[model samples]
Each structure stands twice: as structure tokens, then as C-alpha cells.
Target chain A: MFASRPVVHPMEVAAAPANPAQQQQPQGVLMKDLPGMPGTPSGLALRVTQFLLAAVSLAVMSSTSDFASVTAFCYLIAAAILQCVWSLSVAIVDIYALLVKRCLRNRRLVAFFAIGDLIACGVIFSGACAAAGITVLIAQDLLMCSENHCSSFQTAVSMAFMCSFSLAPSFVLNFWSTAFAYRVVAAG
Target chain B: MFASRPVVHPMEVAAAPANPAQQQQPQGVLMKDLPGMPGTPSGLALRVTQFLLAAVSLAVMSSTSDFASVTAFCYLIAAAILQCVWSLSVAIVDIYALLVKRCLRNRRLVAFFAIGDLIACGVIFSGACAAAGITVLIAQDLLMCSENHCSSFQTAVSMAFMCSFSLAPSFVLNFWSTAFAYRVVAAG
Candidate 1:
């Protein structure tokens, strides 16, 4: 009976096996029987959805502000650039893990990714807090001293700091979720 | 032989069994033997660390802002209030979940809590993004229109929105983790 079934390797198992019993098998078994696809459709769909939501959210946020000012535009450009770098770095790290099959270990890589991601989140969060703080301070100054008395240079510096602070949490959370997803994928 | 062994209920199990053989038992078996107790000391430490880190991160971010006017103080206060609310809400929800043993069965309450948590994460994310966006806009306006002409009112609004947006994912993650921990406690 065992011989007739053939000695199939674990990796061939399909992600969504035809039989639920088969689906419960280990990853190696699934990988062996299943085709070696570069990426799973479900994973791709999830990534696309996350990207779309992020884009929409960012767009909505940007729409609320006047982008025509050079200072504002420069800040926006810098933020955009930073975001790109942060996201790409995460993706690259994930890909590297996947390629190496280190993802299978459920090991320290998850923690490493988590730490890196959190640092990024911390940066973003810090930026936001600083911006909000500065905004409040500037508004307070204006209310107290009149618009002419408010220091523009000081205010600008404050805004930059606030924006950076606010974004810090985001990077942390992103790292956390990515690590979580990686664990799930590896387990599956 | 089975009957000879003491019929300890699942809820009586505290932490992992000392026996290596029993430690490897299925989660269901482990849960049946141990009722909930204070989680491992390490887990508690981790939670405390996370809270402190988050607080420090927020503080650092606030310090960076220029706060030229009294209005800036208003924004800062608002941001602080929101953060406090968000954090407290999470703690409250966690406590409630623990007390009620909501982690056991799949129920409407769990779903409701999950949704609420997701919304919170969204709020956090949105706030952060908006703060960054507003900073850029303010900088631009300052450079183009002069110090007196530039205002970050719109950016402030955006920060509020972004703050709301960022809270969702974290909420979901926390809820699930707590639920899992509950199961672990119940099973042991």
C-alpha cells in the first residue's frame, strides 16, 4: 500500500489541497507535491490590498494639505522617499528569508525583522508626534503673540521634527505584522 | 490504568507540566488541566516594556516640534489626549477579555472587540501619516508665502485622521494574541 502511494516529498503538497486531510500535513510534504510557484495568489492579493489601502490613506492625507509651497513640497518629497526606502527594505528582507528557507525554522529571523520594522515605526511615530506637537505650539504662540510675533524658522523646524516622530510607530507596526505574516506563511 | 490516574480537570493545569512527555501533549489536553493564572513573568515584562517604549517614542516626537504659537499647544494636547485614550482603551479591552474568558469560544463579542481594535489601529496610523503630510505642507507654505502666511491647520486635521487610521492593525493583532494567550492559559 505504501509503495503504490509512492514516496512523495513534503514540498509537493498544494497550498489548498483537494483533501482537507492532506492540507493538515507538514510544509515539506505540501511543498513536495505542489508546484513550485514563485508566489501564491492569496499572498499577492493580500499585498495588493494592503498597498491600495495605504495609497488611498496617504492620498486622502495629502489632499488635506496645500502641496504648492516649496517647504511643504520638499517635506512631502522627503517623506515619500523615506517611505519607499523603508518598505523596500522590508520586502527585500522578507524575500531573502523566503529564498533561504530560513523562514521554515521559525527562528531568530522573525525577531530580527521585527526589530528592524519597529525601528522604522518608531521613526515615523516620532515624526508625527513632533508635527502635532509643533502644530499645537505654533497655534498657541499665534493665539498668544499674534501672527507677526510667531517665529517662522522655529515653527518650520518644529514641524519637521513632529512629522518624523509621528511616523515611528508605523515602522514598528509594519515590522511586527510582516514578522507575523512570515511566521504564518512558514507554518502553512 | 487510565482510571487509576487522578482525574484532574483541564482547568487545573498551571503552566506547562514538568514532565517532558506531558509538555509535548496537544494544546487541548494542556488547557484542560490548567486554569488561567498570571502569565509567565517574562510575558508581563514584555508588555510593560512595550508600553514604556511607546510612551517614550511619543514624548520624543513631541519634543521635536517648534510650537511657535499657543495653537501648537492645543494640537499637542489634543494628540496627547488621543494617545492616552487609545492606550487606555486597549488596556481596558484586554482586561475585559481576560475577565470574561472571551477567548474561549468564537462569539459575536469577540468579533465586535476585533472590529473595535482594528478601528483603533487605523486611527493611530492615520494620525501619524497626516502629521507628516501637514508638516510638509506647512514647510512649503512658509517658504513660499512667508512665515505669517503659513499655517498648519489642515495638517492638524489630517494628523487627527491619520491617528485614527493607524490603530486598526495593532488592535487586531493584540486581540488575537490575547485570545491565544487565554487559550494557552485555559489549556495548561
Candidate 2:
């Protein structure tokens, strides 16, 4: 009974359209997209921004010793450290590539980059999010004590938000470059 | 002074050795690698596990309404919804690909999957981290209240940790498939 309905391959379905113009689009995109290239100006800029964001996230969250009191806040600090290390390592490589006018051609290195970025991305998100939750409570009148504590909470939340903004671009850039690099390797 | 160093193009570097064996390995990997293919059995299982983890995370955290008072607990519920929605959507598509015995061959769709998975990963991590902070506060005697509250806090922290565990595999699987898909498209 199930065989009554014709099953088709996605490639066949796409090929059936027989539109030459349509077939050309993906290659065009593959050639034009720069987000996946490792040492392009924009890519380097993204790495730099990521490093700065991690620094900002760590710095702002740690502005008050009170953060040591909350486990989530502590988690954020640790995540920031991971993010910073990864970003710095990539940035150094990117600079080397630029100065030497050569690409990072190692497939293993690219794979490692992809894995590390993904993990750091996850770590930073968790840290910022946990801290955000705490800050939200403090913002919404959860803190019944000193105005000093309230101000500190407000400052920390802003830092978390900043961290989130930084992470978004870094994630996009990393995913794009990793895909692009793999595609290049596959095609070669 | 910079001109003292020789500059060479990346393509030229790759072309220089002209190793026939090296040329063949990428395509072999392209054909054999399952990580980059969607709708495979392992891919589907990863999604299902993610959905279940999110469910467990929410259910355990919400065993008592007391969590509602804490903003991080509320955030965890919201993050779980995001995780579930993304997981279910991908699973449905994966099922279709399996039933038809065809790949999800669209480049745009694969890109969308990568972006969505990354975002959800970030969201869930954040929620788990936030709730983690609060639970630690309670466990460390920072709460200064009822013993029942302390017990509930312990339970929720354990659940968040489980959520973290589940998220790791899903992220890895998503990254692998997305990279593979892009490589296929680029090669084509």
C-alpha cells in the first residue's frame, strides 16, 4: 500500500525542474559568501570583536566581589575565560595568515576551530543567561536591601547583555567559516 | 622589510605538492562521513534525545511552584520551549527524509538548521546556567529559609546538569551535518 505513492530522491526532484538558472544559484552563493573564509578582513574583525566581548563580559561581571557569592556569576566568569582563550588563539592565527598572505591550510586545524568555537559559544551563552536571570530579579525589586547591591546587580546584567551581543556575531562568523572551509576541502 | 619574505597564494601552496593521495582523501571522506548528512538514524536519535532532555529539565525544575519566584527558573521553562520547538521541527523533517529515502538536499534548509540549532543551544545553556546559579545559592545556605526549599534547589540543579549533558551531543551532531551539507553543496 505504501508503495502506491511514489518515493523520490531530493536530487531527482530538484533535477526534474530542469532549470539551468536554478542549478547555478548555489555555486554562486558558495563563491560570493565571505563569512566562511578564515582570514578575510571581516573574518579577522569578527575574531577581534569576539575577544573584546569575552573580555568585557568577564570584566563587567566581576566588577563587584558580590558576584563570587552567586554560582551562576562564577560560571559566567569561567565561560568568559574559555571564550577569551579560543578567540585569542584564532586571532593570532588570523594575523599570521594576513601578514604572510597565506591561508591556514590544515584541515585538522579547521576542524579543531569548528569544535572549539561551538563549545565556547555554548559555554558563554550559559554564563550570560544564568547571570541575566539573577540580574532580572534584582532589577524587578527582588533585592530588598542596600541601594549599593541594586546598582551592582544592574551593572552586571548589562554586562551579560553585552556578552550576548558579542557571542551572536562570533557564532555566526565561526559557523560560516567552518562550513566554507569544509566545502573548500571537499571540492578540492 | 616586509618584502624580504616570499608571498604565495593558498591555492598555489595546495597545488605545489600535487599529491594524488591527498586529492582523493576529501572525496572519500565526503562519501563516507555520516556526521554531515541529515535524516540519518543517528541524526534523528540526537534530536529526540535533545527534546527529552529539555522536557526532563523543565519537569524536574517545576516540581514545585516555588521556582516561579526565581527568574532563572522561569527562564528555564521558556528555554525548554525553544529547545523543544527546534528539536521537533528538525525531527519531522528528518523523518520525511528517511521515509522517502532521500536526503534533505537543499543548501538553504541546511543553513537554516545550523542557525536554529545554534540559537537553541545558546538559549538552553543560558537557562540552565541561570537556574544553576540560583540553586547553588540555595544549596550553599545563602537562601536562609526552609529546608524544603533547599531540597528543591538541589533537585533542580541536578536537572540543569542533565540538560547540559544532553545539549552537548545535539550541538555536535548539528554541526557535523551542517558542515557536511555545505561541503556537498560547494563541491557540486
**Per-residue lDDT for A24-126 in model 1, tens only?**
5543222211111112232223233333333333443345433233333334334434544655554454465456643322324334544554454444344
Q: Candidate 2's error at A95, in angstroms?
A: 3.6
Clashes of 1: 110
Pairs clashing within candidate 2: A36-A176, A36-A177, A130-B130, B36-B177
Badly placed stretches (over 4 Å) of model 2 are A1-38, A100-102, A164-176, A179-188, B1-38, B89-106, B141-154, B164-175
B15-35 per-residue lDDT for model 1 (tens digits): 333455544655422222112
Please give fnat for model 2.
0.54
- Whole-model lDDT values for every prediction: 0.40, 0.65
DockQ (C-alpha based) per candidate is: 0.14, 0.24
